[model samples]
Target: MSQTGYQSFEELIVWKKARELKNELFQLGKAFPPEEKYRLTDQLIRSSRSINAQIAEGHGKRTNKDKIKYCTQARGSISETINHLIDAFDCGYISTEQLKRYRIRFDELEKILSGYIKYLRSLPGD
Candidate 1:
């Protein structure tokens, strides 16, 4: 139905992985200090969610070019999320181990997203 042959972005492995990471980050945000409720926690949750949101939005686009654009935005969200994670670490909200674990997961997601973008670029014109 879509350019990728998938029925929905939800069916994409990259999107699924992004969703998993978003959920994990959401849980992690819950433990943040109440004082940070409007700051770091909010930013972390929003950026993590953006990755999947962009993917889903891109999947609905009619052109491969549009899809690639959205995926690129999702990649940007990934970077923003990692930066927030680093801030959490600096603030002592998360341990170095937790930060490293998230970094690895995000790295994998970035690679997968890059692959998806490459595949899109290989497709014929819109």
Candidate 2:
């Protein structure tokens, strides 16, 4: 919890954005018909949230390599989420507007994650 020597990337910007995406995901899934509760709904929410959780886990690892690995996993989770979101749009589980919104956020995060990974890879003693 100490701020000493902590990286700026650990600030609330990324976490806040990810948290907002997770909330929107929850709302969108909740709007789905009850029949989907244990199916697409659950899957979508789980995958969406995993992206955020994995990033934080990676940060907590404190090793550049380990952090990069978790960020890679998070990127994979985001890809899976994008597919699910597309499916949700196709199935009318979500609006095209909602999909667009989530897509934009996901894309932004992807770029950030990619940059972080590249930066990590470029570090000495990796």
Candidate 3:
């Protein structure tokens, strides 16, 4: 659907993907061992969710610079999420299939976000 009157990043494709990634990460956390419930699992889930949260917050800003700043933060959160996912995989908390799914989703989100960033840069402001 057209995002024409949608003033926030919550209505954007990348944000939706990030939100879905957060949900999946939460579900993935549930499969982890009980000992990790409050440790790596929690951290991973939080980081995943934060990415979209930052994007929404950024979109609320009136200026493109501020929006890009928040978008950068969101991207950083994505990196953190990817790192945590790698840690989970190395620790054997998730299977290869699960890792593949996360990577694929992250990649798509990254592309959308990157495109948005480029668009913002092309705006009148530096």
For lDDT, the strongest prediction is 1
Tens digit per residue, CA lDDT, model 2, 2-89: 5686764447355557777878889888889899899888988998888888888888886789988888998899899899899889
Measured with C-alpha atoms, the lDDT of residue 14 in candidate 3 is: 86
Q: Write the per-residue lDDT of candidate 3 for residues 1-126, one digit (tens) a residue.
A: 456755456668888888888998889899899999999999998899889888888888889999999999998998999999999999998889988888888988988898998888899973
Candidate order by decreasing lDDT: 1, 3, 2
What lDDT does each candidate get?
A: 0.96, 0.83, 0.87
Which wins on TM-score, candidate 1 or candidate 2? 1
Candidate 3 TM-score to native:
0.90
lDDT of 2: 0.83
Name the regions of candidate 1 deviating beyond 4 angstroms. Answer: 1-6
Clashing pairs in 3: none
Q: Which lDDT tens digits does candidate 1 get at residues 1-126? A: 589765777879999999999998899999999999999999999999999999999999999999999999999999999999999999999999999999999999999999999999999987
Ordered from best to worst TM-score, the candidate numbers read 1, 3, 2
Best of the candidates, TM-score: 1
Clashes (backbone N, CA, C under 3 Å), per candidate, total 0, 0, 0
Check candidate 1 and list the clashing pairs: none
